[model samples]
Target: MGVKITGIGSYIPSEIAKNEHFGKHHFYNEDGTRFGHENDVIIEKFKAITGISERRYLPKTLVTSDIASFAAENALKNASLNKEELDYIIVAHNYGDVNYDSVQSDTVPSIATRVKHNLKIEKPTCVAYDVLFGCPGWIEGMIQANAFIKSGIAKKCLVIGAESLSRVVDPHDRDSMIYSDGAGAAIVEKSSEEGGILSHYSATFAFEEAHFIYFGESNNLELKDTRRYIKMYGRKIYEFALSNVPDAMKTCLDQSGISVDEVKMIFIHQANEKMDEAIVNRFYKLYDRTPPKDSMPMSIDKLGNSSVATIPTLYDLVLNNELKGYSVKENDVVIFASVGAGMNINAIVYRI
Candidate 1:
């Protein structure tokens, strides 16, 4: 039996944070100097380059698990399956439920565990756990679910990517503006029909250039001992992803023994519009062709960089025919690819 995504769902917070929501104090220049009101140029450049006009943030009452549970329920409902039917629940997140403080104060009852509880599942056979593979966590979960179904270890799995990013962002940090809160999920089950997940490849190059996105103090150039927030090297990450991600996708397609022209859609991580556009262009250029318009659908314009949630959420939109001029149909081939924080890169080929 092949593993196939039977259903998909996503949840974005109601609170919309716009680019102008942040002021001068929230940014700093390359030299660690303050980026005062004169930083409007930076905001303009970010929106122009990343295509992100706004993003979501959870209300004080909502946590990562709440968003996860909502999306999970929608996925299960879309599949016309009950919670009891789930053989596995795999949640992918970089940090657990972050409160308003943005600090991970708890981990025992994992985000997956919390989601399980929130779902109110009573079946003990429905095991649940979490994966921490940077932005590729959900893809890794899907790969693992494919293995499980192929090996007869599971009949159905609920794979989810959820995060409360606002909790981890430093208000004074411009990079934080690109982060958002949301969740996405899919129901992967065994299928007797052909055209499911076809090929997979993953690699880590941390030793080459590590700690691109890390947690550290909130102060200027100095790395303080205490405050905890997400910090990123934007230019370095952009360069790294450009150099490696496309090759990884091409390698995956090559291994699948399929022509790049056969790809109907590509659900890439909604990290940055310009970077993603560059990656897709280069991927097609390898075969001396150009990417078809609308071949790659994006959600970053509405949701910013939601890390692991990007692919699943985008897939959900496509599956539901919510993306204009972009939809998935049978016999179509789709490629999923991502590169993020760990300097980790992975890609999967799926046939519908």
Candidate 2:
């Protein structure tokens, strides 16, 4: 049986924050070259660089589950399915709601339990689990879901990618400017059709790149404050993307028996506008094609990088008819690719 995406949903926090408003905060320096001097300059830069003007954020009262729940409910509604029908739920997140009781284990079951109770899913026998792989988490989730269905362990599954990067943002650092809070959900079920997840490929360069982008604790006593924030060697990370993502895409396409030219769209992780351009340029040079114009659209300017939520949010935009000249059709091949912390890169082919 083929695995197919039955529904899609996305949630951006309700509080909309513009660059101008962000600039007013004292932590934002007017002469900071990282983001530019003036609010207008920064906003213009964000628009020119990332194609994003504004993004939403959750209120203090809301958590990652709140955002995921909204998206999950909407996904089920869009799919015309009940929550009780899901045999499994996978919550892909790097950061979850801070709960005293739920600190040590996977947060998916907790989030799933909330969803089940909210929907009154009395007989839901869903196995809920969490996956953390930076921006590649959703692709990993898709692969795992396919395995579950193939193994007859699950017939219907809900995969979600939700994050609240705002909580982890270091206000003093300009690097954190692009991050925001958001979530995306998808309903996947067994199908007889040809379109779905076709091939998955991923690789990690473990040596020098390990320090390029990291978010966990550090061994240095003097760097204790760094543990609480996300850190990145931006130039190094960019170089890694330039070298690795295209190659991963090529491998994924090869495994799927499809050439690069056959791909209608390339959905690279919405990491940054510059990184996206670098990947698109490499793809064009390698394939002699124009890199599918508008293929690497950015939500970073508005939403920052929502980690795993990037691809699903982009998918949601497509499903809502927000993306121009893009529509999913049977047999159409789409490439989902990402490079993030852990210095990891992944490419997966999907037939929509």
**Whose TM-score is greatest here?**
1
Residue-by-residue lDDT tens digits, candidate 1, 203-305: 8888857799888667466645465888889999999998889899999999988898899989999999999999999989888989987899999998888
Scored against the true structure, residue 84 in model 1 reaches a CA lDDT of 93
lDDT of each: 0.88, 0.75
TM-score of every prediction relative to native: 0.95, 0.86
Measured over all alpha carbons after superposition, the RMSD of each candidate to the real structure, in angstroms, is 1.8, 4.2
lDDT of 2 at 127: 70
Number of clashes recorded per candidate: 3, 2
Give the candidate number with the greatest lDDT: 1
Cα deviation at 214, candidate 1, in Å, is: 0.9
Stretches of candidate 2 off by over 4 Å are: 25-52, 99-120, 216-227
